[model samples]
Target: MAKTASDSVSLTRQAYALTDDLMTPNAAVYWIDLLVSAALMWGGFLLAATTSSLAIGLVAGLISVLALYRGLSFIHELTHIRDDEAPGFRVGWNVLVGVPLMTPSLMYEGVHNVHHVKDRFGTALDPEYLPLSRYTPLSLAGFLFVALLAPIGVLIRSAVLTPLSFLVPPLRRFVKQRLSALVINPDFVREDMARVRPAWLFQDIACWLWSWAVIAATVAGWLPLRFVLTGLAIFSLATFVNQARTLVAHHWDNDGGKMSLDEQFLDSVNVPPPNLASELWAPVGLRYHALHHLLPKLPYHNLGKAHARLAQALTPDSLYHRASQKGLFEALTALFRRVAVKPVVAEHGRHAAE
Candidate 1:
């Protein structure tokens, strides 16, 4: 980041101060919401996989997918939180949502922090970023379709490669560097695993064992093929939905350069209240992506209130108001408009969605 980038954080100070008190994450809120979402996910998944009626199965499957998506979205919160602040929440989340879904918190834990750095926020180094708006419409179509591969990719990573990598140290290193992160940028290699070895070993072993158990159960006829297939389909659908939300999470307007904190905030997006659809699509305070850029430490439960306070306190010309989108459709329409016309001359780091 440019030295000026650090100097200009004065622009964000008010937002930070306004939301200072909101940083305390409510433990009760996290526990209740997480457990309820898990229960709904498992219950709906069972009905969807085993029910006799096709219509009922389809409806239950959709609900299950949405619930699972919401549960998985908590990984974002996990990434921001310190273990001292919210003791045991991360472990509970992994046991309930991450391991079962094949997207253990390890996939995102040590990786997402880089995206928040001013120098890296929208540049090639940002693992969570992809310059999607500059891509051709056809390429964007492929982007959505390709996200469906997430389930198979995770299964291979956890089940097949984990054990093989353990046997071959070089393969283990390669896997850790290349495939360990839940990143959009495939080239983003992880270098921080040594810092997280204990947690990594725990989650990695659990995921490996769970994957093998599922496979063994299917092979031994202890678990129905239909149920396993249905679960994959549901997880794949959830991945697709997340990718769709990701498309609107940011404007993707940067051109692979170090940006000021203010520039990074504008580059992001926010789909705030009265937009009920946003709650379904961008769960877990993600709807406030831009506000999040401003107050990244604010807990998910407190994001809405923080946003309202800023909206009322800040003037109409403030950056906070500009970050707010009316709803999902409006935000998506803006993205579609950007992609509708392929840029005549794309620059370095401007490519198809990751």
Candidate 2:
């Protein structure tokens, strides 16, 4: 007999129940890691500005971009973290990364929860999902290309759209529905603009104020143009790396149908044997994405241990094994190859019809 969704859920619950002790968040570790990430980002900017050597600056910038990418990834954790577990971490993150980058935590807070909803995953309602595998190679390219321009788009939203939206209710509604989301699926529409939460409102205002302040400072010669440009460059590069990671984060093969809990896990991706590359590229527990869908409340720091426990508890034939990929490169190549072969398959089908 085949294992059913209930069986998968039962197995996962059993696996996690054994690792229950690991779920507690270590406040000290979280703070130290976040502080170090911020230092790396700002330290890169300082190195780039103070150093005359282009090579040195480039190396420092690359390091900073990688660190910033990891730092920003903590936003995903914020959505899942309980306030009692890590007090003030969310506000600190907003001040350190969100306000400066124009990607406030509020944008992802309520939004990402939808992706984890059992019935919503891979559907139009899931903000974080899209059916990329069904599209042509050209469409895939377009998707990534748009992602490359995300930094600029974020800046525009903060500097231009954010303030304008506040003044005009219609524009605010439009922005809330179309722009405020941290989503990949274009079809995911947010219809809850009128019921804005206080935290979201506060974060949005902070982002707006910080964005214009940066612009004003740059224009008034208070902040150097080169510094501003360099910061934007780092943000752009980091966001691009994130976009690339998002591309291969899953199989992206779902066709807008509701999936069972087991099917949802199968649809997600997990890069096991966590190494340096996985740590850097898919930081903040993203490498265990499929497992995350299974156990949403598990803190990021504990994901590794959770994986270990689950791997040992589950049999070799578990659906967990199906979601594991060798590494980032292999996963991306698989996606690309899938897109490339899609056209050929469609052509063959057309000829068969003739």
The best candidate in terms of lDDT: 1
Kindly provide the TM-score of model 1 when superposed on the true structure, using C-alpha atoms.
0.93
Question: Which whole-number lDDT from 0 to 100 does residue 69 have in model 2?
Answer: 91
Separate clash counts for every candidate: 0, 0
Summing lDDT over every window of 10 consecutive residues in candidate 2, give the lowest-scoring window. 345-354
Give the root-mean-square deviation of each candidate in angstroms.
Answer: 3.3, 4.1
Task: List lDDT for all candidates, in order.
Answer: 0.84, 0.82
TM, every model: 0.93, 0.93
* Cα lDDT of model 2 by residue, 1-354, tens digit: 576988777867786787789878897778898999999988987898668999999999988898889889999998888887888898898898888888988778778988888778777677887777766777677677666677788889988998998899899888888888899876667766569688888888888888889989989999888888888788888877788889878887776677777778788898978555888888888889888887888888888989988888777887777889889889888998897765322211111100
Worst 10 residues of 1 by lDDT: 344-353
Pull out the clashing pairs in model 1. none
- Superposition error at 194 for model 2 (Å): 2.0
